[model samples]
Target: MQRATVERVRVAWTRSTLDDRRAAGRALIRELTAELVPGADLRIEQRCPGCGGPHGRPMLPHAPVLASVAYAGPWAVVAVGSDRDVAALGIDAEQERAAPDLAALFPLTSPPDLRGWTAIEAALKADGRGLLLSPDQVRLSPDGRATVPDGGEFRILPVATAPGLIVTLALRHPDPGPRPTRRP
Candidate 1:
């Protein structure tokens, strides 16, 4: 995992198998629980408590960390951050070329428009507030940034790992500092 700082936020990414992903998710909950409450052992289940949603958004029995999970192809990405911070984190991995129609398999499609839709969904999950925003309410720019409607304060970054898969993460408290410039 690489932990870097864009502004003051600590960002990290890890590539793991399905089993490792589950374990890593558990570890994340444990670490966050330790930080929020001393001497408290938190056991997080990998299932959603709300209407058996396809994306299992786990809720902490007692904690202040907001987390989201997404599974793409064979990889599962889980992001955790402070509840008040509202950092939207998402990740998707796929083969370099096109494969079966994911949309047909799952109700959600991975078209370009899906990027903004995912970002809005992620932002809503991170905010843990009302369900006022819809997939149609957000728009993704050609450069891959998403602008939320209603002047909601958020930062949207869409990541393309391969040719066919896209993951969008939206953070309400995005760091405004200049992004790190990479040299070829």
Candidate 2:
């Protein structure tokens, strides 16, 4: 990790113990990026959806690798794949029995809605649009595929992870094959 990243983690810890998870998510992204591109200068950019600040999705702007990192209760996940094969990638994990009650909590209205919500989140992250778009704008095909309102196909694949963790990986269609799933 870079000095800035390490210092950010320390500062987060000072704020609250729960913020440790965010730090872990950052560290995991660094480790995974290193593994994917060995010996190269790894520079990560956190592109903010709202203000373009240093607090959003972690992106390797220079490396020929595409990645997405997400964290939830008891889980922190990073998805790494060749930029050639994957133009965009997103991964999400949440407790099976957990659901946020916020109106913008991924648009969960029922049990079946969970998968759609997860799929939307993954797609949004992959599109680099984050939550800037309303969750209600996401449309899921009856065949279980998800599409952004403006129209672009995303394949949502169910990932088998630890028990009680509902994992989903989203990538723009025309993908070649599976990449890797790193957890911490």
Candidate 3:
């Protein structure tokens, strides 16, 4: 797969057991690195920073570091960055079957409701901002579009492997063009 452009967003999915899930995630990370940074050897592993839980983030033994990881349930996803750009990416995966309390975890009171909630969480993480805004402050449209609380552009893409998992990527940068003038 080609490297995703700053304006483009991509999501990849694979089915596997818990162990296989982690392996698949690592493989994806390698592939991404190859696509993003050609001729560079990359290796990814899960290590605990004395936190008991496995840390899914990747680390490059050599210099020029860039990568991030997010794993939920039996799925793991990684994003690799470029030299001039910081990698702002997020991934989420969930079981295809309905869980007993999934609704409670992610309440879907109405249609188009669930994607927004998921997008907000993903966007915040992607921008390195977490829980900065309340759930009600952000809104998601019926067509998978999301409006950031502070007028930022956010892109949301649903993961393919799992029905309940949704991944969102948000990019915020200074406006370089001339500002639009409004007439009353």
Candidate 4:
């Protein structure tokens, strides 16, 4: 976990339970990084767009690995990928719940269901823009493909994990090659 992340979590005035949950989620990212790159020092860069703060996308500075973390309710997912395999990778886990009012408010981009929403979010994250772009900018097709801004595209794979928990992995395709299909 980054020091800035730790400090932000510490200073937040949320409930102790919430703090623990957030801390655990951050710890999961650290644990995954350690396991993925054993015996190597890992540094995460969270460069905010405006102020270069710790609220930006997580970047592996010294390695070619890319990672993203998302936490919703009691679920958190950490996804990592090598540059050779994917230009960028994102994963999101969401709990199944009904929020009918939200649909009407964001009609144009609101997904028909939670899985679709997760897929779009994962694609946005994989694009390295996150919510910086409106949902309308990241159109999710019925075929689990996403048309991201900047002419990029992503392939989304959704999986049902524990009950009520949906996980989606989005991969931004690297440049075409003879073995483009191969992944690490």
Q: Write the per-residue lDDT of candidate 4 for residues 32-99, one digit (tens) a residue.
A: 56665676557676886656677667777887667777666655556666666667677766767732
Give the clashing residue pairs of candidate 2, or none: none
Off by over 4 Å in 2: 1-17, 102-112, 173-184
Off by over 4 Å in 1: 4-11, 32-41, 45-50, 53-55, 87-110, 113-137, 141-153, 158-167, 174-184
lDDT of each: 0.50, 0.64, 0.52, 0.64
**Candidate 4 wrongly placed segments (more than 4 Å):** 1-17, 98-101, 104-110, 176-184
Estimate the TM-score of every prediction: 0.53, 0.75, 0.55, 0.75
What is the per-residue lDDT of model 1 for residues 1-184, given as tens digits with 9 covering 90 to 100? 4332332233334556866775665565466546655665465654434554433555565666555555555454455565555444432233334333334323454543355445656655544432444444555556545555654545666554434555556565645669889999
What does candidate 3's lDDT look like per residue over 1-184, in tens digits? 2123334333444555776766777677777667666777676555544453565345665424355555556656555555345445544333334222334443555323444545666665554444444444456666655666665555566644445554444433334569789999
Candidate 2 C-alpha lDDT tens digits along 51-162: 9778888777777776677666756666766666666677776776886554645445532456666777888887778788776667777775778876476777766556
Better model by lDDT: candidate 3 vs candidate 4: 4
| Model 3 TM-score, all chains together | 0.55
- Write down the RMSD of all candidates, one decimal each: 8.8, 10.0, 6.4, 8.1
If both were scored by lDDT, which would come out higher, candidate 2 or candidate 4? Answer: 2
Task: Please say which candidate is ahead in lDDT: 2 or 3.
Answer: 2
